[model samples]
Target: MAHDHQHNHLVQMLDLDAEVLEDFHRELVGWAGSLVGDRPRVVDLGAGTGTGTLALARHLPGAQLTAVDVDDEMLEHLRHRAADAGLQDRIRTVRADLDGDWPALGPADLVWASASMHHLADPARTLARIRDTLRPGGAFMITELDGFPRFLPDPGLEDRCAAEMDRLRREGGMHMHENWGARLTAAGFDLAGERTFELEIPAPLPPAARRYAQVTFARMRERLADRLSADDLAALDDAAATAAHRDDLTVRATRMVWVGRRPS
Candidate 1:
């Protein structure tokens, strides 16, 4: 919806699945519980719609929160969400790009990015900044996609879908995935813990799924329309719909959570 690319598709798809939001909140709050003592400091990057930020605020009553995002409209939504959660005082929304120089607000106890790092042009540099902003022994958490799901009834469809995404990335300058843990280690973050979760989204694909498919196809078609036959586009859409209809969807979208420390 925002960037009009593969990463955007993944974001829209996750938006379709409300469960992902709840899980992210659960994870963030669980993490905040570990660091929050007497009024903790937390920073959320790429805080679109403020779902994660507001959720974390609900859990960390005494937290001094800063939510940063490039899109003002999304940040507005986050503001409303924070207000709705009665956390207007505890939360402050900052309109700043994560890829740029961060404003002078730091010494955070927790820095979290959910499904946002891959969108950065230079994630390594950003993570290093995040690490430096943290207080001693502070935590840096990043969640990244392992890959798209393979819930297609046809076995080859999954491979074809993956190939299409790969092609689009190479031709369209799309950033679909990343290994933030490796980047964190390179940025001098000690790996404290890690977890992986596989989610099989329930489908019969609703309008939300269709919307996501159309957005993704438009991105691919934008670059490869000359090379991609009309039939190929049709087949991809059909496969997406088919995958959405499956009982379990059996999608293999894996989310990796990496926890690192600033070393007290």
Candidate 2:
């Protein structure tokens, strides 16, 4: 029951992210569409909630997509979303732990990994595998976040929260701040392009943004329950409780994307 609740919250958060940041998502999808050929075969690594899978399918009508993830629940949700979007014909879900032996997913035109590579045990090994999985001259795109977004107007509390989160992630062995471009080059991929997106949605955000703030605060509170001071914990509770109605909230985040290609 606890797992189900967590999964539901994650699903809602991902869906809200796409909705609240529609401009960025649309631009990213369009850029991806421009990189592939007609009827291209694409693979989405760690396709949570089918955000990228469905978007790529809609943007490239002729493309076939394989959405791969370890979690059965997430894959099931992706499949349902694909069907609902009338993209089931072009999209298929594969269940596999990316850190383990990967299943046969190869000879593809494009492979996309967004905010997912950091969770892998060995990203260099995974990058090499991805290179082998793609056809010669195929493209591999990786997108990673610097950290979680901040919605509060005052930077002090959010900064403290981010610092704590970073420490916890580091202790947990998450590669939250790796230089992926260097890793790709070292793993034998030809670095094709790199871009950083700095996004900021000012005060009086949409309803979805408010909910996003609430969910993010709640998740942070839960994760840092033990690490944070008592005062911080109380402040977090207040933030989560009031996030939905805050008028001064602003959404700020940074995402970096690196595109590499397998040498022909």
Candidate 3:
């Protein structure tokens, strides 16, 4: 289960000017090139709003995708996106929980998990299933945030927000750091490679990117409302208000990616 409304907002925020999504797919496909065959299938595990699905549609052209997620609204959004892009024939939505019984999807050439592994009830077990469902030599790529957003113009304020978010995560029993490669190895995957992407934009990002960053800060402000001190809260207000301004605005973020393959 997920906070549907919040998840949608989160998607809108991180999808920086749409370039961020392209960066993700570019890196993923770059790591494992067009592995297309007769009806190539790519599983978008825990696919939220089909961000990764749509990316694959463009880069991996001519491949079928199964977008699996428990959130129906998110899947609906994905469906519409696929339809708009004239990719509905190649993309199918499945409402299923990553923790529950696996859906009826057949083996895939590559499985893409973007910021969705943490939500699983049992990530390790689910990973093994992912491995088993992949064809020989299939690849699995997963991405997770190194930490919360650090794109504020002010580093000091961003640190304060990050520290508070870390505390909240701890209190909520959320798992933050997991050795994804090690888990994949245990799940019978041959470690392939991994990398960390630094998404940084200079001040005065495009109008869309600026609005994206502002939305991100607004969501963060809402989440830290009760926890931030009076001074910190005021600083956040200033940050949120100026997030969309072109003058002296900067954005920085890190996304960790782990790639593995099922043995041939």
Candidate 4:
């Protein structure tokens, strides 16, 4: 039983069963697969709803995953999800504040910090801590958006919306951009190259994916209602309305993955 706020956010990005994250899971697992051992011990920071955890379970089969989040409700749901996937014994959850000192995490083989890294009070420090938590030769990966998805068809609408979104996120104490490779280096991890996942689901996306996109845009519009101009807002509404009806919609985003490894 998740609290309303936690429940709503998770529902926005994931379906009741975490099925909507299949593509998300695939992208992440694909990048980490070569690095993870058959029985690797892994930790996911900011493991919201455990979407990535579920991905790891399916891919690594034998991976021991520790999912840490500040929200107990999310962790609770993650537990249920793992059980449903018949992976309960392989997944563990920790309620934690990633900004403060980390909890008893790992000598883990892999550290997966997705959209959560930039949310940290000091991302560089956290990255360093992540390195220390990993076993020698352990791997680290941070997946974050370069920007929001471009949904508005109108010229300039995407820019205005993205700018405002940045303001709102900064106000929420989130840092939306960082040279993560540099941060990882500063944190004492050796760089292992990076990749950008261009997420474009040709439309008539499965019902869940479509719903996820709809929720994403709707939430954006709501967040920017106060900051966006009437004209811009109206344009956004038009885009949203059009998106809702059409199957040829373009749900596009760039997710950058920075990989690193602690010296063995």
Top TM-score hit = 2
lDDT by residue for model 3 (35-107), tens? 4464568998988777788888767776889999998877888898899999998899999977788877768
Per-residue error (Å), model 1, residue 124: 3.3
lDDT of model 2 at position 20: 89
Q: In terms of lDDT, which candidate is strongest?
A: 2
Off by over 4 Å in 3: 1-8, 34-38
Model 4, stretches more than 4 Å misplaced?
1-7, 14-24, 203-206, 234-238
lDDT of each: 0.68, 0.90, 0.77, 0.78
lDDT of 4 by residue, 1-264 (tens): 334643575455644224654666586787797897789999999888888888887889888999999988778888998999999999989998888767888899999987888788877678778988999999998888866566434438788778888888888888778888888888888999787777666656676655666666666677777898899778767766666566666566778898999998
TM-score of 1: 0.77
Descending-TM-score candidate ranking: 2, 3, 4, 1
lDDT at position 142, candidate 3: 88
Residue 140 displacement in candidate 2 (angstroms): 0.6
122: Cα error in model 4, Å: 0.4
Q: For candidate 3, give the lDDT.
A: 0.77
Between prediction 1 and prediction 2, the one with superior TM-score is 2
